[model samples]
Target: MTYKEFMDSQTQLEAPAHLTPLLEALWYAGRDEWHRAHDIAQDNEHDPMHNWLHAFLHRQEGDFGNAAYWYRRANRTVYSGGLREEWQEMVRTQLPA
Candidate 1:
């Protein structure tokens, strides 16, 4: 599945408000707007989803090391995890090749 599809599903499911910012971050990340995503992710410290988003942004910006670190800090996983691979892949594709 694509990142946009995953995001759309989350939106359709009425995902948590805390995760909303993460979605926004993903939206910005999709557009290669890391700063905007980072800005959105920075506002929420309490949500693991926010950390996941931060990690994704770092990954998208080519900071693979910090991205992994943040993902770990965020306790990221697939099932029941804060963020999923499809979305992460979406973010990943935004980075410069």
Candidate 2:
């Protein structure tokens, strides 16, 4: 789904059926369920998308150093600021509709 659409469609418990693992992670993260997001992201560590989402999850959990490590694994620069900002950037720049 489009990033905006995903943002809008928050009435459900599970991730959209068509979304990838990274998207699933993003969905759970947006709902403030870091553990759920982390579970999905951690399972697919070989993928850069997984690494990025995993990093974001760690960031949400207040683990900055671990987040930085995963960001490096994802080949992304470390980020700071509110979770919403990071989530929007990741959704817009990393995921597909």
Best by TM-score: 2
lDDT of 2 at 44: 96
Candidate 1 Cα deviation (angstroms), residue 58: 0.7
| lDDT, candidates in the order shown | 0.62, 0.83
For model 1, the stretches where C-alpha displacement exceeds 4 angstroms are 1-19, 77-85, 88-97
Candidate 1, lDDT over the whole model:
0.62
**Taking the tens digit of each residue's C-alpha lDDT, what string does model 2 give over 15-90?**
7788777877888888988888888988999998789888888888889999999999999988767878988887
Please write out the lDDT profile of model 1 over residues 43-81, one tens digit for every residue. 875677777777777766768788887678779842333
Where does the lowest 10-residue lDDT sum fall in candidate 1?
10-19
RMSD of each: 9.2, 1.8
Shift in Å, residue 56, candidate 1: 1.1
